[model samples]
Target: MSTKNKRGWIFLFALPCVILFCIVYAIPFIMVMATSFCNYTLTQSPTFLGLDNFKTIFADPDFRVSIINTLKWVVIQSTLHVLMGFIMALILRRKPKGWKFARVAYVIPNIIPTAATAVMYSLLLNPTFGVVKMLYEKLGIDTMQVVNLFGNSKYAFWTVTATWVFYSGFNMLIFLGEMGAISPEIYEAAQVDGATAGQADRYITIPMMKNAFGTCVILASVAMVSQFDIIYMTTRGGPGNSTLNLPMYLYKIITLENNYGKANAVGVIQIILGLVLVILIQRLFNQKKEIEEV
Candidate 1:
């Protein structure tokens, strides 16, 4: 086929997907951007406000708290969550006893719906009739004197943090897939050279998984920024907004306060924040070389 004909055929095949993407994603994004600068709500047409929504978001103390809380969750997700998955992958790399079963068990947390998880954790960590207090009491700690984990300001943030940070099953699956692609020859060579298992992993396995780690870091961090269901189910940004994050705060602006423009402004901020994090993570992981080559 002539190059021109091939190009035409390719465009014809791609047109449906292109149109669908524009309709589903691009159009909503454009609407959000347009409405964010105006005062809008369900009952009224958008009125041009020219940055007023953004200004209100910044001026609100609760929004500032949400930003700080969301940033904290992002850092923890990108680092600790990714690390947990990496560690699990390394553990399974050695093919320990029943590693396949262990992998399945680990993924149960991620597979459970966030609403169910919220409920489970709430019941498990309740001040009374909760395993946490029972365990604390058994350990000779006075649970009767302790506050409910999700109710107290001091512990609520950490409690909510715990819910997602350790559920690294998604990361584990990604890391495992990346690790599986590695050549066995490298491990074999290390073994022939009298390298211990730890040395082989440190020098070969970990170094080679850098790209996968970078990808997981971006996925986990962005998930944190957009997280809402679990928090809404558990704390509802209560106990003085201790567990509040960007998405939860955004939802409140629309549902409770009925500020559509402010919600869209928050959405714009989320998109920009996500883009910045993606770029920074890619640079940090040295994925730019791969991108450039592509």
Candidate 2:
């Protein structure tokens, strides 16, 4: 085929993806931004409100609390999630006994349905006859006062965090892939230099895995921003908005109050936060890459 014909074919093939992006993501985003300034509801038509929704969300006490809670989760997720996953990757990278099975087990949480996972955690953490409750009782802790973890103001947020925190299987899998890509010669060089296992892990493995760790950090952080399932299923932002995050808050504003404008405003803020985080993380990692190259 002629060069012109080849170019035409390339454009034809790319058109579908471009059209899909517009139809799905781009158009919806535009609608959300436009509607966020409106006063439309189930019973009324959209009338321009001019930032009223944004003002309302900012003023809302629950929204403020949700911001704090979400920020806390984001920090925890980005750090703890990536750490656990990186540690697991370091272990599995050696291809020790049962490494293949261990890899499969790691991602089991990711494959499970979120709602069901929440339910499972709830049952396990239930105050009465729950495995965790039973263990605490065995450990000689006072379980009677703080029986319902999800219902208690003090324990609700942390409990919800615990439910999802340790399952760094997805992050582990990502790190594992990155670890696999690393050249064996690098580790051999360290071995030749008489570097201990811990020293090698500290200097070589960890440093080389910076890109993967940064990617996990961004992924984990953004995932916390949209975290709704476990909170919704377990606490429903209850115990007085202790565990409320942006997404659940958005859900309540839309579903319970029919405040679509405020919901979309929350959504716009969420999208902005996610975009900013991704850029910041990429820049942070890129800077590290540059330093390493130097």
Candidate 3:
């Protein structure tokens, strides 16, 4: 085909996707951004409020707490969650006995619905008839016997963290896929150079998986930023906003408070925050990759 004809066909094929994206994502984003600057609710049309919503959000103590909590979860998800997955991938790579079964078992939690996982954790940590209370009694740990993990301010944050942090199966699968693509010759050469298993992994395997790690970290962090279902299903951002994050706070503005203006303002902040994090992570990874290449 002539170049001009080929270009026409390419445009024709891509047009549908472009139109769909504008309808589904672009238009909604623009609407949300515009609505963020207005006072909007279900019963009334949006009134231009100029930055009042943003101002209110900044002055709200709950918003501050939510921002802090969201940032904390982001850090934990990016570092500890990704690390857990990486460690599991490394262990499975050795292909010890029952490795296949272990891999499948680890993935079960990830495959389950998030709401279901939250419910299971809620029951397990109910502080009354929960399995955790039973275990504590069996172990003679009286101090923890009366603790309501999802209710108390001091323990709710960590309790919510526990429900999701160790469920790193999705991140593990990403790392495992990256590991599988590595050439066997590299390890064989390392063996020939008298490198021990640890040395080979440290000097070769870990370094090679840097890109995958970066990708996983970004995914995990963004997921944490918008995490809501589990916290809502379990703690409901209480007892007294203890486990409140951005999405949970946003949910309150929309549902409980019936304020779309403030909700969209929070949404805009979330979008910007996520973008900033992604850019920073990309730059960090790129800089490291360049240094390694050099």
Best-matching candidate per lDDT: 3
**Clashes by residue pair, model 3:** none
Which 10 consecutive positions of candidate 1 have the poorest summed lDDT? 141-150
Instruction: Report lDDT (CA) for all predictions.
Output: 0.91, 0.88, 0.93
Best by TM-score: 3
Global lDDT for candidate 2? Answer: 0.88
Task: Give the TM-score comparing model 3 with the true structure, all chains together.
Answer: 0.94
Q: Report the lDDT tens digits of candidate 3 across residue range 63-154.
A: 99999999999999999999999999999999999999999999899999999999999998788889877888888888454788899899
lDDT per residue for candidate 1 within 65-165, as digits (tens), equals 99899899999888889999999999997899999999999999999999899999999988898888888898999877757989999999999889878
RMSD (Cα, Å) of model 1: 2.0
Error of 3 at 73 (Å): 0.4
What is the lDDT for 181 in model 2?
A: 86
lDDT of 1: 0.91
Kindly report which residue stretches of model 2 are placed more than 4 angstroms away from their true locations once superposed.
Answer: 132-146, 287-294
What lDDT is reached at residue 158 by model 1?
A: 92
Ordered from best to worst lDDT, the candidate numbers read 3, 1, 2
